[model samples]
Target: MTLEELFAPFGLKAPPLRVLGLTLDSRRVEPGYVFVAVPGVPLPHRKPLDGHDFIPEALAKGAIAVVGERELSLPVPYLRVGDARGALAHLARHFFGEPDRKLALLGITGSKGKSTTASLLHHLLQAGEKPAALLSTVGLRLGKEARPNIGHFTTPEAPEVYGFLREAVERGLEAAVLEVSSHALALKRVEGLSYRIGVFVSFYPDDHLDLHGTAEAYFATKALLVERSHLAVLNTRLPHLKRLLPRPHLLFGPGGEVWGEGLREGEEGLRFTLHTPWGSGEAFLPMLGRYNLDNALAASAAALAYGLSLEKVLQGLATFRGVPGRMEVVQKKPFRVVIDFAHTGKSLEEALKTLRATTRGRLLLVVGAAGERDPRRREDIGRVAARLADKTFFTEEDHRTEDLQAILEALAKAAGEEGGLYEIIPDRKEAIFRALSEAREGDTVLLAGKGHERTLERGTLALPWDEKAVALEGLTALGLGGGEHP
Candidate 1:
């Protein structure tokens, strides 16, 4: 397509240039490609490599035109935009033919519950005869494609994000439930796409200082989704929900528009009363914790808003198997092994508190910290693990470009200073094995972090690994791998 055709979506006149494809990264530029240069938000005294530096490289690669920030001198056609990221989103939509318009789009945003809620919402919609697609930290699964796209980041780049959505639409998917991250909102990835229903889960302050610089900025990023969504489903349980003042929104919680009351925690999952706009019904989730009740309510609201009846939605909820790694059970051997993706202090506390209620024996928690993002959470996570877990095993969780031992030392110091019971093991697999080896019948071993992750990343190596699979191997060795406790 010509550059004019590509820029049509942005309401800008296309330059006299032919472009074969579009990209923001200069490395991916090729002949007939339009490169978009987006200036990164500088962090305090530090500054990011400006997109202008790559304009020359992109042009050298035969890029016909460049959509970039102001102050650039290039021989090729260039269009200056006040917000380059927003322009990229708009251009990509037009270039991809606005694929999301053809597919049902559900946007979920919050500090937590986005991934799990998106996964569950997709499951429920598909169960109700709505062929659905999902894009989340867990991975993208559309039609028969199940392998996660290559990346450690929760949300991919704008082009990749739109590419995945376009692929889902091409596969004839009727619905796409996406986990909209704060970074994606701040970067304007969802700037142009229209969501049929937007669900605002709950929020907690974590992993934002580096990008957003402050808690208020993080909160504002989340609010953008609520403001733009056609039907906003807010979690009334959030402590700051009042401050958000979500418009065109229906509140949900333990006693709100969509809720799960009378919750009864169980050994495997929790059974609760699910209340929705249509009617209230008793619902049983094969997943643990009160947080999951909120997740279910959030998904229930989205499904209902998308036109599924309360009966179909509740039926879907009843039959929906939980997402892997989110309160997922790995084994029920001589002991029970539960694998969860709880990395935050609040998440760990909730997981441990929930498990402590059901476990007959010692509650063991194996957790680790992800390097490079939020260093502040290291000690906090360790402290929480020590306070709640009877036995805490600390291991490495994706220490990309960071020293694993150094990271572990930080956590160990925090945990030790707090009088927490914990041990440091740099290898996550070894930590899991050690936790399992220490477990006895009736004991509950909770493997926190790397819940449904299929790969164990270490430096440049990504080895195939699954917590559920490893725990099952141990359970089978113990002769208790057939089924759950009867």
Candidate 2:
């Protein structure tokens, strides 16, 4: 497509330069590529990263044209728009052939449980004999093939997201489940895509406060997803859910369109009879956290709304193993060592409480808070850790350029308020080793924060980190579990 042809939809006159591809990153700009200069987060000392500054580099790299928020005279065609990110998203949609028009799309959004819910929907689609793709925190799955997504961004930039969707459509996939993040909605990363069903799992006001500036604004941005969706699948119990979405929605909870009865949780997992408008069936979710039962129902409602049978939904639920780092059990023999991606206060509380119920011995916790996001969450996390766990290890978790000692001390103070046994461990690996080494038979060690993340940010360095692998190594090195993985 030529530059003029691409911008014609926006009613803008452009040069007839042929465009081969699109990119937000100037580093990736190549000859014939249309570069969109989107602003990025600021580094420690550097000013807020802006694509405008890199236009020269992009042009030098042989970019045919540049689209940015700032108006500037350049050697190549320069189109200035009010929202460059939105323009990028739209142009990416156009460039990718608007795959959403060809594929049924389901968007799962909220503070937590998005990955599991999206995964469940993908599994249900496959179980119902509909080939689909999934883009979630765990990984990307198209048809029978799957790959781990190692990045921290749950929702990638517009180009990559649309590119993945286009690939899915090309591979003859009929549907896709996308795990939407607040940043994605706020930045117009998913501007042009249409969602057949938007799933609301759970929301934490404190989550992404650093990005949205206020809790009200955070929720308002999140509400945009359901507002754009053809149907919203929401939890009936969350009062805020009904308020945010007024359109046609499927509520999954007591007295809602989809509800569960005869719920049971044990060593195996959860078993509940799911009741929906279309049909009803007994469902068993092979996942921990009874709270996740609602997530399962949310996914079921989305699938049922997407034209899947209740039996297939239940089948997928039964066969679906939980996402990695989400209530993931690392070692199970002597003492249960579980690694989870529970970072927020609500999620951490839920994880700790759930483990407490199953623990015959003391409940051990190794938890930490990230730096530069929300300062209030550190207090919440520390208080929850101390109030619940028998013993808590306050340690480092993505403390990028922040004083690790101060963060640990803040946790100690919060734990002091709870009058619980707690110790500050600066090194994350050491904290895991200590937690595992001290755990006794029947005690469950919950490793909270940094689930499925391949890197740990401390100062400016993002070092390699694998929570489950580190826990297993700690167990083996401690001469506790068998040398081989459990």
Candidate 3:
């Protein structure tokens, strides 16, 4: 493609020159590349990262032209625009041949359950003999296999997003399921793409408040996906969304278009009778926990809206081994060990409550909150753990460059307020081992946060770590099993 063709659609004039590729990151720039110095607000720093700062790196890396919000004297061609991110999205869409036009997109968004719902929906669609692809917090899946995702962004930047969609089209994928985040929508990472079905999972008032400034703004940004989609699938539990989005949609909770009845949790997982607009049928999930029922119902609703059979959806549910680190069962013998990605207050409470009820003896928890985000979440989770579990281990969880002790103190104070039994362990691996060592027969141990994640951040250093592997290591130390990862 040529520079004229890429920028002309966005009303920017540039010299006609061959453009090999498009990228926002200067490190990825190559010969004849159009580097988008997209100034972004990914963090809450007083001095935000401006793409203009990376111009020299892009030039040194052989970037043919620079597209950014700032105007500066450059060695090569430069185009200044009001919104560099939006322009990057549009130019990528143009260069990628508008791949979304071919692939049917089902966008699942909210603070939580996005990755699970997207995975479930992709599974259901493929069960119906349709080609599907997925982009989620867990990673990218072209088919049944997944590639480990890089970085912490749930939704990656526009260049990668469009490039993936372009690849999905090239692979002849008929559908794509994406886990959209509030930051992605607000920052225009998903710009210029319309969804066939926009799904809204449950929301928490305390999630990502650091970025949205208010719960109202955060909720509004999530609703943006529904604004552009042809159909909106929402949870009836969140009735306020109906008022915010006045458009017609499929509600998936009690008294809604999709509902689950006779829910049962067992050794085999969860089983229930699922009701959808199309029809009702018996459903079985290979994953445990009642909280997953909501994820199942949400995915079923989107699949039904997408014209899949009820039988196919149920089959997909039954065959799904469940997403990694999502209530994953690491060991089940004298004591049970579970690894989950429950970092938020609501998720932590639900997970603890579920395990607490099933525990024949004590319920022990290994949980911590992330850094550089809301502190109120840590307080809420701490209190919840105190009330739900017999004992809690307060430990490290991605305290990136922030005061780790302050974060732990917030949790410890909340636990103390609830009169909860707890211990402060700064080292995450040590905390996990301590929690495991304390578990007795008939007890259940939960390793929460940092689920399925390959890295653990400590003072800006992303140390290589795996929660499941660490849990197994702890189990082996207890003389129960070997350290080999199952």
Among the numbered candidates, top TM-score falls to 3
Which structure is stronger by lDDT: 1 or 3? 3
**Reference-based lDDT, residue 427, model 1:** 80
lDDT leader: 3
User: Model 1, range 1-486, lDDT digits (tens) per residue?
Assistant: 678777665676867577678888898999999899988667542446677778889889988888887876678777889888888888887777788788878899888888889988988888888888888888888853676744656777777778888988888888888888888888887777667778888877665667888887888888877777777888886656776563567778856778777888776666887777788888877777867888888998888878888888878877877777888766665677888988878788898998888788999988998766678878788889878888888998887667899889988898888888888887887788788888888899999988878777787687788788787776666566685742
Pairs of residues at least 3 apart in sequence or in different chains that clash in candidate 3: none
Q: Lowest lDDT 10-mer window, candidate 1? A: 40-49
Model 1: per-residue Cα lDDT at residue 288: 76
Lowest summed lDDT over 10 consecutive residues: which window, candidate 3? 40-49
- RMSD to native for every prediction? 3.2, 2.4, 2.1
Please give the lDDT score for candidate 3: 0.87
Over 375-407, each residue of candidate 2 has an lDDT whose tens digit, in order, gives 778888888888899999989999987788988
After superposing candidate 1, which stretches have Cα over 4 Å from the reference?
A: 8-20, 26-32, 41-65, 70-80, 143-150, 239-246, 454-465, 469-486
Q: Quick one: ranking by TM-score, best first?
A: 3, 2, 1
Residue pairs with backbone atoms closer than 3 Å in model 2 (clashes): none
**Cα TM-score per model:** 0.89, 0.93, 0.94
Query: Candidate 2 versus the native: TM-score?
Result: 0.93
